[model samples]
Target: MRFTTQRKRFRDLSEQEIIALAISSEEDDAQIYRGYAESLRADYPASARIFDGMASEEDDHRARLIALHQQRFGSTIPLIRREHVAGYYTRRPVWLVENLGLDRIREEAEAMERDAERFYVAAAARTTDADTRRLLGDLAAAEAGHQESASDLANRHLDADTRSNEDATARRQFILTWVQPGLAGLMDGSVSTLAPIFATAFATQDTWTTFLVGVAASVGAGISMGFTEAASDDGELSGRGSPLKRGLASGIMTTVGGLGHALPYLITDFWTATILAFVIVFFELWAIAWIQNRYMETPFFRAAFQVVLGGALVLAAGILIGSG
Candidate 1:
């Protein structure tokens, strides 16, 4: 299927096909901008307004292009699109871009405009007719000026205070959706599993057995934490964000935290592996402390003291139990 479904080269397209491609590209761009507008409307109304303006601009472009097509060719334009042409510029799926940060979305928009400008320039160069070439050149200029238009729109819509508030909201959403749950999961995995893993290690003095226990504890804790986080909050009332995203963050981080020290047990030398594991535990505690300080806004020294003390106590308890 892949080999059979060959894409047409942009250079080989007729003027009508190029126009059709432009129409579809403009349509697609308009839809993407609308999707962005809708996505940000709830949180960043100012940014949403900017996207709305851009979408309207795209619609205008599409309408003008369609009028030109009707005047030159016919009422029935070909259904050619970006995907139909090989080496044509492509837009990312709106859903993928929408899920990113607000600034990232803006950057993507800029990139889209640049891609359009470049396409139009090349199309104008390849055109034989004076009118078609002039039209393509004009479109290219319009696309080039879009960044300035967007800036003007931002200036009118997104004032300094409003922009700051929206940015803050975005950051808070990120913290809630990712950092908070992930931190909790990491701390739980790194600290809670410590006693069991260390106890097993010291008790058995078997590297393979310790590795097995560590892996089991890490995986089990990751699963439990993931499910619990997802089930606990639907994100509608709490404003935490999508439960699936939070669950994934929590799950992945939890496993990583437990596996940090667990992996050292693969070394054949018992003392060497144990020493490395001890070192890894030290680093894990510090990392948890750092994350708390960075995202949760906890005082660094206090977070370090608490995490290290709690971990040390659990580790001591495990060692004492194993020795007895």
Candidate 2:
């Protein structure tokens, strides 16, 4: 005999169990919608209103499901949930929804309703009980109606101008939360580590020693930048998003930036490693300039001039110090 833990299949669930699951799913969806509403209320009020309306629709569905359960299966509802049933649709966390951007949340909401509609239709087919089947059919139709009317709801709450404004806000939030911090980290790691790494290379004339110094400098800088960024802002007022995410972006990019030039020191020949490191440093500066031009909207030539000049000065200082 084989012993295994397995979830109950959807088709194996009884009418009462199915109804109970439906009620629970509706409750979960309603809570999720409300969470989306609350999270977006501060930054994107228009989008928040749409979520609020969607939550209201979910509440209506939940009330009807409960009323039907009371009429047929009595006041006590079963404790079954999506987790109890195999192959059931699962919802993503509400926090993830907020991070997915405003438009993506709308798309997810639409998909959630469609999933509900499909589940109910399937449940209606599996059940033999008249009342249960009827209830499932009604819920399916309600979900379909919600999907159909979703566009109308958006039109009512989010007009063209409001939508555009909301999109701009969402973009700005993304830049602030992820891009800006990451770019800062990259710049710091690339430029700041350049001098030390090159200076060590010139001073030591040993590939292994240069590589070790570069690794230590890069790793240290990454740790410092990550912690600094996370501690600098809680994101309550700045709306930059979760500190952990920002810290990760900053830290990872910083490490990458430093590692770019650092890795070249693996070459045994001093001149070869020095040449490759210089090449890597040159590209890193250009990349920093390009990012500034693209995301920060700084003028291309101006950014290039600023970055290249500063990087050259640092490079020169390192070479001179090492040579001395």
List of clashing residue pairs for candidate 1? none
Estimate TM-scores for all models: 0.95, 0.88
Residue-level lDDT tens digits of model 1 in 68-118: 899999899999989899988988998898987898999999999988899
State each model's C-alpha RMSD to the native.
Answer: 1.8, 2.8
lDDT of 2 at 291: 89
Error of 2 at 239 (Å): 4.7
Model 2, 309: alpha-carbon shift in Å? 1.1
Candidate no. 1 TM-score: 0.95
Clash number for each model: 0, 0
Best by TM-score: 1
Model 1 residue runs over 4 Å out of place are: 1-5, 122-135
